[model samples]
Target: MKSSLRILAALAPLLLAACAPQQLVRHQGDAASLAQQDAREKQLAHADHWTLQGHLFVSNGQDGNGGTVTWTQNGDRYEFILRAPITGKSFRLTGGPDGAELDGLDGGPQTGPDAEALMRRVLNWDVPLGQLRAWVMGTRAAQGGVAQLSFDDNRLLSSLQQDGWDITYPAWDTTHQPPLPAKVFARKPPFMVKLSIQSWTMQ
Candidate 1:
């Protein structure tokens, strides 16, 4: 009985080592996965054409508005529709790199050199719609501006600052290829916009 007990005691250390949790292994694997995800995002930045349908909330110091937003991008040409359900008002914005045009529910077509300026002028909302095309996909816009970017534990974009607006992505839609921001918010003091993407498709 004494010899048997000694044998069991001798094997205890080996058994415990074999059953130890794989914490180090898991952390290393996670780091590799993060690197892969970062590479994928960088490649996805070149994608210029895609569609997104979502909801938007805007506060422009004077008033607050909530509505549905449908945005479509095809190369340099893009179209965005913002509809306010309560007021039954809908606005469509379409444009390219050189300029943009806005069609309000109550006014005629308004053209401008910039989409952000047009929105603020016509809709009384300060929204950076042009930059939002890239922002929604978790990347900085290409119009040449300084952007401060932040990443999550998984090396995914969590927040960014561009053109004086601070943007934050709280959740991501991992169900889609390359994954995109499920919910994003941008604030520049007097102006604030919240976007929630319900669907995303890439081409």
Candidate 2:
């Protein structure tokens, strides 16, 4: 019995050694995946000319708005249009290096120095449109440092914190190379925005 026990103890070390290789392989695979994802994000950063059709829902912890949204991007210029189905209300926001213009409000067209300021003044919603241009594309915003980041099993961005906002990607359109966000949800305390993308066109 003593000899048998000794043999079993010796075999236990071999079993543990066998598991170590698998663990190492898994760790290496994870490292490789993260490297690939980083490369993909770098590539997407340069994808400035693209269009996306999606549904957007925004809430300010009191009032909520939902609509079909179409966004077009051409270099530094962008146009975001949101149309409410039931109310037939629509808003168009266009901006570039020069400035931002918002139309289809109660008053005449509104213009401001930037889109974020204009949105807050006209819509009373504190939305980070500048950062969203990158977040919506499933990448980090170009300007700010990320506070936190989490990845899914597929090594895709699952959640991130930046500029006091917590953003999450629940689904991805893997049919596209490097995949694109299918659903993006972002919240900052009383403000929350959710986007469900239907299609994407890169130009």
Worst 10 residues of 2 by lDDT: 11-20
What TM-score would you give candidate 2 relative to the actual structure?
0.81
lDDT minimum window of 10 residues, candidate 1: 10-19
| Candidate 2 lDDT by residue in tens digits, 138-202 | 77777877556667767777776688777777778999997998887777766666778899898
Q: Which parts of model 1 have CA positions greater than 4 angstroms off?
A: 1-38, 114-117, 120-130
The Cα local distance difference test for each model comes to: 0.61, 0.66
RMSD of 1: 20.9
TM-score (all chains, Cα) for each model:
0.72, 0.81
What is the per-residue lDDT of model 1 for residues 34-134, given as tens digits with 9 covering 90 to 100? 56556766888778888888877655455555667777889988887766666556667778888878666333687888766665555444455656666
Query: Which residue pairs collide, candidate 2?
Result: none
